[model samples]
Target: MVEALKIPTTLAELEALGEEVTLRIPASFEEYLEWVDKCEFTIEYFNNEIVIMGNASYYHEKLVAEIIFCLKTIFNKVTGFSVLGSNIKIHIADLISPTDFNADVSVVQGNPKFVTLPSGKKSNSKITNPVLVAEVTSKSTIAHDFGDKLLAYKKIESLQYAIFVSQYQPFVTVYERKGIHHWELRDYTRLEDSFVLMGQQLTLAEIYKDIQFEK
Candidate 1:
């Protein structure tokens, strides 16, 4: 028996090697482990391809950190609700899609058991469904987040609110579930405007409070 060949180290190498070797498609956990082990590119194996993700700009990190801090403070006191940032792993096995997404901020209700797997350990698995999911858009992924990804995210039965926070503009586009299979889209830019979410109203000013920018 021949020894298993080592995987290519670079994306270019992998592309070329694809023609020669028959790869053993691994499970989600195995895929994640392989991805982490092979770090030539900042990529994630979602759907089928290796999606190379761009690094976060400083401004993006600041915004995400602030938002996470605010959410954590709010949810910690609310009870039955917990807040998480991109660090969390959200697994969707319906079609073998295990996406480790950076959910600028995600809130869920219930205490989830932490489980360890080959890929990584998840402290909260209760996030099979998120009550609200927000993505702070960037220049490169604005279209994906607002367009295609928005549609894809809508397929999630537990998703009630999908909010896209614009990086170019100081605005937010909210898609809220209206009925059984319908969603109502709304845009909010005004500071004092309140957006109702799961019976809780959040004012734009409150969410963006203390937020500063270059211009």
Candidate 2:
């Protein structure tokens, strides 16, 4: 009988291991991630590797739901806009072996009717050109959220805004594109504080609805 290998204990070691595994055969790993029999997990494909994500907490999900509700309500009054579920994969870079990242909630532009892109092409695999993207933070992902993912997201030509929400406390960070590859940042810590992205407003209080924090 063979025992499973223990995972690395520290972040640096784990990252090194992940790189080693990805360099071995990226296609095989990517295929397994998209397999139908795969378990329920929020997986991320970045830098030629798959990141297995754990289930979000109850509050985390609720916060996401509320934000979606707000987004839908706002888009309903507008034209050529819609929101996407977390399952939508986004090809942030080149289509060939592109790095796909799933936004918790994404705001896209489309006609009031269901959209059929150029030449009536449609896809469930991945999307690009989202104007706004939002992410709800978990304890393990704070650094990746602000560092690595932020860099990747800003590279999207059509991406004008990137927002990060905190589940552990009443906090939010809004990144607005300023110039070519330049982003201006703002942080909100008060419940009454709100962040505006793509002409939509989201208050911190509404995000933390029926939830409390240790801080």
Candidate 3:
């Protein structure tokens, strides 16, 4: 949490910071996190902080499963890429704790490689690059998903598309990359609206198949 301390210019300060830097984490922190049941609390590393995600509602989980099934049908038959679920974290930075994202589902071009962490240890808990990321909005996370997280997801150089599916309605937003840093936004709400995401096509109705909303 400590930020903006003047960079140590002296040898003594360098030695002091080296020892103090490792003190930031308890020795058992990683060990505990590894054994923690994600079903209880979805934990993610955001910048330098650990973010505990709120639980998904039944509807949210159902939508996630449906969308994952649709994506698998397309990518598995044509793309030959790995289509993974939420537990797969994608590293977005190389900071102290690092910024990693856990999307509802991700269609990746290939499996991620082991990356050496700031602590000189290799972490096997992330997908370094993904092609498309999707999020099923929840009441507690819609704000971050539509705001900061959307911006962060675009910053991933390998990312070509970002899809946001509504949990409370039959709407979906797809951001397609046009060129370097250029993106096109398309929202599909009507059943007739066809989503042309990364050259693949699907109707909004197809995504919301067999799902009922409160009247």
Candidate 4:
């Protein structure tokens, strides 16, 4: 493993820095399993750089739970597709992505796989394919969660839509992947309107119902 270069700006610099990026020293997969069992902090490792995610707020948790519950109930009635919460893992290998970089909620096509090994370890990461994914944004991660991370997720072939829920406003931004290489952007600011995705639609007023927070 090489010493990772500090964040570089130039494309040439970034290309040069890539060689210096500390690739994960191949460790025993079993040992990683043991570490996962004991680790406490929710972390994400991408391209060898580790990112520590901050804690979620009360409103964040509440909104996440409500969305998952609603999706579970709705999808259960329409099809066998299931809704999974942050307890699941989504990983992209050599990608130096994160660990427990939980989406507020995700919909998977089949039985849930709790431990999704990195692409380097498995033929296909368990969470590589998600019908829809949601993130409850907070002040601490408004930028990355909405910008850079969203860009990374866009690279995923199986992701259909990525959602951003803001704490400052009732508005939500939904990015739906269109065709094969494009995304359709839609904004919902009206409290009465709802955003539809994958297969189900959820009203903003209902999703944020009874919840109050700093304006």
Per-model lDDT: 0.62, 0.68, 0.69, 0.63
Model 3 lowest lDDT segment of ten: 19-28
lDDT of 1 by residue, 168-198 (tens): 5568789999876899999998877777766
Tell me the tens digit of each residue's lDDT in model 2 across 116-170: 3334656555677788888988776667678768878988888888989888888
The lDDT leader among the candidates is 3
Instruction: Give the per-residue lDDT of model 3 (tens digit) for 127-169.
Output: 6688899998866677778875787788788899999999778
Clashing pairs in 1: none
Task: Estimate the TM-score of every prediction.
Answer: 0.71, 0.75, 0.77, 0.73
Q: Candidate 4 residues 1-215, lDDT tens each?
A: 11232322234543443322322333334334434444463434443344434456677788788777767767876775868777656654333434334577888776544444444354223466676788877766677677656777777677888888776678789999987799999989878988776667788887677667544
Cα misplacement distance, residue 17 of candidate 1 (Å): 22
Assess candidate 4 and give its lDDT.
0.63
* Deviating ranges (above 4 Å) for candidate 2: 1-39, 95-97, 111-122
Stretch of 10 with least lDDT, candidate 2: 1-10
Error of 2 at 191 (Å): 1.4
TM-score of 3: 0.77
Q: Residue 203 of model 2: what lDDT?
A: 81
Query: Which TM-score value belongs to model 1?
Result: 0.71
lDDT of residue 32 for candidate 1: 53
